[model samples]
Target: MRKIIENYGSILLLLLGIALGSVIGLLTPHAVEYIKPLGDIFLNLLFVSIIPLLFFAISSSVANIQGENKLGKIIGLMSIVFLVTIVLASIATIAVLYFFPVSSGMASAGVMESPTADNSSWGDRIVKFLTVDEFNNLLSRQSMLAFVIFSFLIGIAARRAGAAATAFTSFLNAGNEVMKQLLLLLMKAAPIGLGAYFAYQVKTIGPQLFGFYAKPMALYYGFGIVFFFVFFTLYAFLAYGRKGPATFWKNNIVPSLTALSTCSSLATMPANLDAGKKIGIPPAIANVVIPLGNTLYKNGSAISSILKIYVAFSMLGWNFFDWNTIITAIGITVLVTIVAGGIPNGGYMGEMLMISVYGLPNEAVPAVMIIGTLVDPLATILNATGDTVAAMLVTRLSNEKFAPSST
Candidate 1:
């Protein structure tokens, strides 16, 4: 009991926090504002950490991988698979959300002011949009594209420096190490943060929110799992053949479970690396893919985008957005997921800003935040499992592609 508690301490704490918050909120309704500040503190802590964490983790990983010649093929194959998986996950999420639909027809819970100020004039809005950095500062403070562009520039410079770049590379590597430790510390506080957030949500929103919202959230999570199986597991079976899902699960399940239980994909890295090797993926590929995948190619965030859109349509009874809107939403979600995947708590602010860009009604923001906090552990499980499967399949396909040409 003690061992299990120690092992799963982070997840346990998160849930405990939620449970406590719910009870307190139910008992003292007026104190909701007091607990709300805790949520703010938690979110601020997470936001401050995400950008630096993502930049170092991804930039350093890229620099290290460049030292290996075979990495190009590995990256190319993995990127193709990653893109396909995200597209499929997006489709699945949208389809399931459409079917399960979270429509309540009820007005939003409170008299909340619009987060956005009046865009009364086209010129004013255009001016704001044209100066994107200014708009982003107003919106979320952290811009995903900006982060990616910055990281890409640093990574390119590091790669070009060759032998001379060792000092910079070491700095990034050290940053990664420090961030890993800091993430663990934050995760330990997850229960408290999640609990406060959860309690505030439950107290303010009540049980009806779940009845009205749970189906779509469940559909979102279901799509994530379905894509993990279809894209990752199915490809593994085709590539491995004699060694199928059974074998892949045998090798990767422990780490997947660890990721789910702990809700920290970074913490599960050593386990995932070991699992990848056990499943017959080369050590070089495993080392390269798992860390990089953790930094990018987040399958779960793709599903979140689909789910968020669906909720917006259902909640506001807004006119169905056009195909261009859908495509734009999916595209932005994919880009943000890649850039922000490495950051602890990066998704919150990014997605908050995304709601407006996608033309989603702001009423959906609280619902999305709730989903982000609750669904994290399960999402991490699906992501890690999917990544391992993709790595194995990519390795097997690369081997076959280069094999002797029998004319």
Candidate 2:
């Protein structure tokens, strides 16, 4: 019991907070006016942190990409594999959500603030979504897409400048650490913040708030299991035909367990590297891929991002079937899952992206942040373990026998 708490104490505390708040809200609906502010304050603290966090983390990760010393076939192959896998993962999520749709109806739908419809042309919307008119505008949450684009450019510029940008790179690295620490400090209040937030939601929206999650939560976990066994097997087979699936599965036990137990992709690296070597991924490939994968590859987050977007859309009373929305959701999934997955509390950053991109009200984030949290354990398994399989796929395509320094 003590061991279980140590591993999962935070999640348990969050759930307990939610339970207590739910009881308060349901028993005394009038308490919302008093408790809602706590949730709002917490959410604001998170929102305030995202811009600087993304600016530092994304730029630093891109600037410090390990493959710069030797980037040719292997790096190219890794990029293809990462893009293909994340796209496939998002498509798989879209298909599942299409069939077993998440519940959307809240008894008090008015509790959610809806964005006013923008009847702009697709071209205009695209430009608006991806760029800000003024530099100052980029700092606001509404310009998250623009800010992300800017960060990537900054990182690329720094990388290209090499020795000239050493000081800038150091600053980015330091800033990333500072932002991570700040977020960690802030999250010490999650149990209270999320609990109060949920309480306000339950009181305003009624207890059906829990029911709204029942199907989607169950479906996410259920699909994660199926995706792990089924799609991962398919990826493995593609990597090393016939015996590949067995080999991949047999070797991944430690990495998978490490991912679950430690909940950190960086923590699972040694085991993942060992698993890749056992599966015959060349050192050149495994060395670059596993470390880079922690920062840029995330099959698990792809699915989770898509689900969070869909749930936010559903709650906002938007049409999920709209072609524009579907395309945009997939695009957002690839960006957030890969780019944002490296940082601490990145899920919340990703949620902020969704809310900003869709013009959804602030309430949408709290609604989806819980889903991100609950799904994280399973998500981390796919993410950490998938790197080895990805390395195999790269190996299969790049030829089986290669020098260790071929990368």
lDDT against the true structure, per candidate, is 0.62, 0.72
Alpha carbon deviation, residue 20, candidate 2 (Å): 28
lDDT of 2 by residue, 85-158 (tens): 89999988999888888684442433443444456775786687678889999987556557767986887788
RMSD of 2: 9.8
Cα RMSD of all models vs. native, in order, equals 8.3, 9.8
Q: Which ten residues in a row have the lowest lDDT in candidate 1?
A: 398-407
Query: Which tens-of-lDDT digit does each residue in 1-407 have in candidate 1?
Result: 99877645554555566667778878877787777777657656655665566577557766776444555777788888788878877766666655666663334532334445454574764344323555345233334444544564576688888989999999988997797678667656656665666566666545443644566556666666767666666777776875667667666655664454345555455456556655667644654566667657677777775666566666776644468767876787776566444334445644655665766565666666666655666677766566677777687767732121111
Instruction: Give the C-alpha lDDT of model 2.
Output: 0.72
Q: Candidate 2: where are CA atoms >4 Å away?
A: 1-70, 105-212, 343-345, 402-407
